[model samples]
Target: MPIRMHDTLRRKKVDFSTIEAGKVSMYVCGVTVYDRCHLGHARCYLSFDLIHRWLEQSGFDVHYVQNFTDIDDKIIHRANELDGDWKKLVDENIETYYEDMDALNILRADDYPRCTDYVDDMIRITADLIEKGNAYVADDGVYFSIESAPEKYGMLTGQILENVRSGAGGRVDDTGKSKRDHKDFALWKAAKPGEPTWDSPWGAGRPGWHIECTAMSMDYFGAQFDIHGGGHDLRFPHHEAEIFQGECHTGCSPVVHHWLHNGFVNLDGEKMSKSLGNFWTINEILKKVDAMVLRFALINAHYRSPIDMNDALLNDAERNYNRVLECYVTSLKGCLAENNVPLPVADFASTNPLSKSLALLEKMGEGFAKAMDDDFNSREAVAKVLGAVREIMKMHNSDMDAVDSNAFSHYAIDWLEETAGAVLGVLPTREMALAEPEEDPRKLEIADEVDALLLARTQARSDKDWAKADEIRDALHQMGVVVTDTAEGPTWDLA
Candidate 1:
């Protein structure tokens, strides 16, 4: 089945097709590079990261471009707030953006075009809009006339010109009285004192927020592209404005094939924002929890559904992630011991427990694909993977011990790579996860103590002394060792 997505323009889940066959050209609105990224940034990028992964996994060539608004009002204000150079601030913050996103395991975009570098392109587009009578100059700067592209105005957000109120175009003083309509937005702003300025046809000024995206995206991807995405809050004035500007500039009605906007990341029950003083930076939260835990919590819901982020959610995600990791580790270890990977389905022709469990694992992988195919339903897809791990544990403990463990081990790793590692992107590959972690001196010192306790637990179990086994387990916990007894035996990790 063809992939489907909820297009913000059509406001419906439609069958997705690229402008070019077997290739996907995507453009996601990037950060303003004014500060360290927060949870909201993670949500937006991860949502599209999953889409990028699935498209490539489905055999489509993906050329993804994300723009950086490096010269925005926010960047200038932030630079002034810190009494620092705007260029230095933008460079430092761009580095911080990569740090935060790389920690969360998001795949980097194919290109990151900064607005400052694209001033020439912005000038060209604004000049063309003026020549075509789609824009007019004012005392302040050039503004795009909404009347020129009336049909494309409400194509995304459905807010027509008649319903547009004063100051709805993202300016403070209503475009300084030269704007044709209250809804007319600035394509270029005339230079202001003490701010960065670029030479443009309109004047020596800067490009507007909305036009930066239009200019960079059109310059990178051409007249039209597939899969334009951003945060849901960008739906209105930001994305809505991009529709008309790109279409009017390029003479293409639907400049972007599909518009996808991921929902917000709410703090507890309220909206998370720096203005509200309730948001947490990505680095800040990662300090308290693992990056994978935060990644899973952020994506545990539908991409278009608002997710409440809190400590409890992170804790739950940690537990769920551990459950899968533990199973994968156990299975991979078995494969290593057997010195072989799982063979083809034809090799598992018997109706024995091993073959049956492998069949179930294959079905669960299909279930994961089914969930993801229906509009990238990652929440349901994660549940399917968890179910596969649970089934693996169930089969290992009861009936699979007598059969060859090769198929189970290799199939388990394959399923996880396809589902968790590929689509969800929440975990690393099986080899990486099973690789010996960097040896800490503290853990090394306690290895002997852990072994002694495990030996005691083993002896207790052999003697049917449940009480002593429980006591040894408690002692191991006090030593900062978390031990779980699998069908293969006991596995312990430093807590």
Candidate 2:
């Protein structure tokens, strides 16, 4: 119940104590702009959004930054395949990324530093690394010497220096790449024919994948910050390389105070990827279900736990999402409809509520904070929120008025709205979902009108006035209702 989180460093849970008290700086590895955003991407961003929300809700002033890899090998390759402009491809995909995330209610990062925008800073850092003897120029470009950094190579990734495998297709020429060890990665790559390039310390070239984060994060949040996060897949080469570069430039060992990574998203128990051909783009999935349900499905399991997304699981998550939203709306309706409403208060409880539903809200709120503090266990924190929602529904069904007065119903609703809505960037209103497909109330109203008209038409038919009966039928049809005659008489419905 106390504010604690599992520190991936120590490999166990510990009480969260920030490097600097009362302030938090967090950065997340953002998208590479070559392709459409997918559900797996949503899982990463949404998970971080919840962590950012909980941190801010817990009274920490969080300056969150996420970067975009706007210029990369994939972006260039994709552009060439389509005979498209490289910058245009990056620009279009970046815009699409924002559109997809906005649809899912993801909080835009305080700073979205694109790799292209920070090329100058990256050059500066590369120059610094070269001057400091941490990087060397290869025939193709500049490479970071793994042997020059302060910590042991592969300290963060736990990869053995000798046995590491480099990624395929883009290996620097072995001649000029004076890596003390073979595992040393690139800092900059010399521009190839038909590739996007910028002028850098080692001639006209682009920043390497890992160097981009190092330069951008240090430029924004200082050489060292409170937290750094990305996918579990990135912990090895990407993040480990980031740490090495940051330390080489800043003369600091741990440029990040804490490291966090969310687990993989599996599609039907297999990793979802382009190769698998089972990747569900966010837009593609949005067409099938609401964004909140997709978000709920991602967070239901622990952040570090793998999830195999299936139709039944998604339906279950949708039901849960609807139930939570319904309870929140119903509670607000009751609170607004109550007497002697409690004034908004600022006191926060650090213990779990055991006695009543209102106390449960306080308890769950505390649990949310504690869970987040413990290393940003957003999965556990969200459980507290869902639990509070469940308790509210139970009380609402049993005794609405008594529950309103006896509990901090007003305050709890406000808290949920603020923390869940503003902070966590989840649902701000029940209206997020479009009109229900089942019998709409307006349709029902029209149906009633149609029935009345049909009754009048039946009477007119019974009176032997075919002209009057036809006139009534035409009038009802004009009102967007269709009437059909049956053996029993007439039945009508809204169109």
Q: Which candidate is the best by lDDT?
A: 1
What lDDT score goes with residue 303 in model 1?
Answer: 95
What is the TM-score (0 to 1) of candidate 2?
0.80
TM-score to true structure, per model: 0.88, 0.80
Give candidate 2 regions above 4 Å deviation.
Answer: 1-3, 165-181, 336-355, 399-412, 418-424, 430-495
Clashes of 2: 6
- Any residue pairs clashing in model 1, and if so which? none
Kindly give the stretch of ten consecutive residues in candidate 2 with the minimal lDDT sum: 346-355
| lDDT per residue as tens, model 2, 1-495 | 434555455566666567678888899999999989998899898878877876776788889999999988788778989876888888898899999999888878899988888888888898898999988887888888887753566666667766677543365343235444566788888877767788865788788899999988988888789878888899887888887889879988678877878888899888898897999999999998888788877877777778889998899988877776776676566554454655333334523232345556677877766666766665676677788787776766663445443345566577677645675555656453233557768777676667777788889999999999999988987887778889998877775
**Model 1 over residues 1-495: C-alpha lDDT tens digits?**
989899888889999899999999999999999999999999999999999999999999999999888997888888999976999999999999999999999999999999888888888888899999999999999988988878777777888667767664555543446776768888888888888898876668888889999988988789999989999999888998898788888999789999999999999899997788998999888889999988888778899999998878888999999998888787777674553544536224666666666677777888888888889999998899889989887865664542366656766777777778877887777568879878888888988888888998999998999999999999889888999999888989888
Best by TM-score: 1
lDDT of 1 at 121: 84
